[model samples]
Target: MELKNRHKKCINFDLDTKELLKYFPKGTRKPYALIKEFFEKQGFDHRQYSGYISKEPISDYKLTKIIHQLSIQYIWLKNCIKEFDVSNAPQTLSLKNQIYNSIEKEENKIYNQFIQKLRYYQSKKKILNSSTKIKYEKELLNLYQKLEKNHINLDEKSLKSMREIAKTKSLKR
Candidate 1:
């Protein structure tokens, strides 16, 4: 500590740092390789990893509380994933199918409009002019924004997220 503080410019910690940080890993450079090494150490194929970790309840309450509170914008996607897990009823299936169709149609319409614009540009033998390029980028951004809006709907998702956060706060008290 004194050497590091005194010789801050030279920074002569190469020898002492190893002894200090020996408890914690110093190397395993890449994250992916580290993850792979961890799984391999855990014998992931043999399910030995379960023994090292505490058991969690098989309930959506925790997931909902965590994901909804922290990542409000992605509440719909998490809800959709939860819905997919145990969607058995005919009504549920029909509703999911209807939603899928609606989402598909909207996405297709946006894509088709962009395609038409591209075709118009092609038809005119234009070499991607500035205004046309701007329009292209605008269309792409519009499509992305629409999809994000669809996911974070006020009544369906964002409201639910707020309610979930409130529920957790109440529980904590």
Candidate 2:
């Protein structure tokens, strides 16, 4: 499938750094530059990439890279929010809330894409011949293991179901 169609199927998050900056504490120096630098450090150049990494295709290797980058950004953003003394400034508190929301949204998008891929492979297994079934099963298992290594959660039931499919296919031959 084309990258555009894959993206259309996944959850979309509006990662507008400019809009995000509007909630930041007033009088902060070089907010735009700071946000730009943050993104760049996250392995994304907003100017060159045209936006965040969330729009990238969810192929196994690319998905791993995207999730890793997002996890790094999530940690950095959380730390930045914590460093702010929001006690005296309502605006700062609001900005923190906005940042938290963005983090959650990004994480959700990652998980949604992961689940979608698992489902895609699971559905494909049904139509594939026994010979090809093992190949698809291996791919699915590898994807699951990679996600687990990165600390991304998989639905236990879904994992079990995939395993059973693979087991049954193997037993057939």
Looking at model 1, how many pairs of residues clash? 0
Candidate 2: deviation at residue 56, Å?
40
lDDT of 1 by residue, 31-150 (tens): 224333443443322123111121222233433343344335323233222111111111211277888899889877765654564445445534777676556545544554564565
Cα deviation in Å at residue 146, candidate 2? 0.9
Q: State candidate 2's TM-score.
A: 0.30
Best by lDDT: 2
What shift in Å separates residue 95 of candidate 1 from its native position after superposition? 0.6
* RMSD value for candidate 2: 21.0
Q: What is the C-alpha RMSD of each candidate to the true structure, in Å?
A: 26.5, 21.0
| lDDT, candidate 2, 66-162, per-residue tens | 4466557555344333222101111211277888799778667666765776677667866879767676666666666656665777678877876
